[model samples]
Target: MPRQRKRACQDTPEPETEAPAGKLVKANKAEIPAEPLGEAKTSDSPEKNRATKESGNETSRYWLMKSEPESRLEKGIDVKFGIEDLKAQPRQTACWDGVRNYQARNFLRTMKLGEKAFFYHSNCKEPGIAGLVKIVKEAYPDHTQFEKDSPHYDPSSKKDNPKWSMENLILS
Candidate 1:
């Protein structure tokens, strides 16, 4: 069974703190609802509209993926990935990789194809949910783990038995 995160109470107010730029943190559990929550986007592209409509499935699970919008140095690698960066990718799809947290990686593994997730912009001056994305592919071995130059490299993770996994997501 997959591990579940602790849910925060809706009645309780959370204290706001000043977080440094490019830091990643778990989102508030209280804000996650059974149904999708966000402003409806109108688009000229039919493909974009289709993805948006297809995401409204009853079985589709929701997740919050915190990505740093501002650039910062981590293990000598510049970490400045954001929602706009995802949109600029080929077919607007990219691998959700470099997750080091054990529990967070497990959560990524549990994400099913077609499921929806909030592209949360964390550790910035105006941090918030930037956009939504749909899981285009299921969990697979994270290629970055095998790259010696990659910041997420894990020397112990052999090709035969990889230690890290990642999912492919498309802009929704």
Candidate 2:
């Protein structure tokens, strides 16, 4: 019988790191520059800033609120949850927090009192518009931003200059 030769793992070449066609490659340290303390800059151009301000000033802003039916439902048939709900009774309004996306944060900042928002259920079997809600108050600092124990807390966010904000909402 012929003896089998042993293969060395180190002798085999490693696979190339090329991405599939049309896919973007991840940026490395050389491609992405590190920000210095207090030197962070925004990429918003003058035109873009003007457009954002204009859009924010426009009345009748629309929004969508997502809630899990199983998590917030009182009765199986109850479609709307309000301040009267046991879980929501302590605070007439709940702080809408944990939004890390800057664009979504900007949207939250644009909410005004009496503004209408459609309540939608995402990641559900039947995801669609569930009900309607009204903005009871304008944007205010989300307290969760300051609590280090909270999952939403951001060390980069200062209490005096909180980056996360939310508004009081009520079922309509």
Best by TM-score: 1
| lDDT tens digits by residue: candidate 2, 70-145 | 3322122223332223133322234454566776677778776666665555544555555555666667777666
Off by over 4 Å in 1: 1-58
How many residue pairs clash in each candidate at the backbone level? 0, 0
lDDT of 1 by residue, 8-74 (tens): 1112222133212222334453444323443344556754443344446334457878788887776
Worst 10 residues of 1 by lDDT: 4-13
Error of 1 at 20 (Å): 32
In order, the Cα lDDT scores of the candidates are 0.66, 0.48
Candidate 2, which ten residues in sequence have the lowest lDDT sum? 31-40
Clashing pairs in 2: none
Which prediction has the highest lDDT against the true structure? Answer: 1
Error of 1 at 170 (Å): 0.5
Model 2 residue 112 lDDT?
A: 68
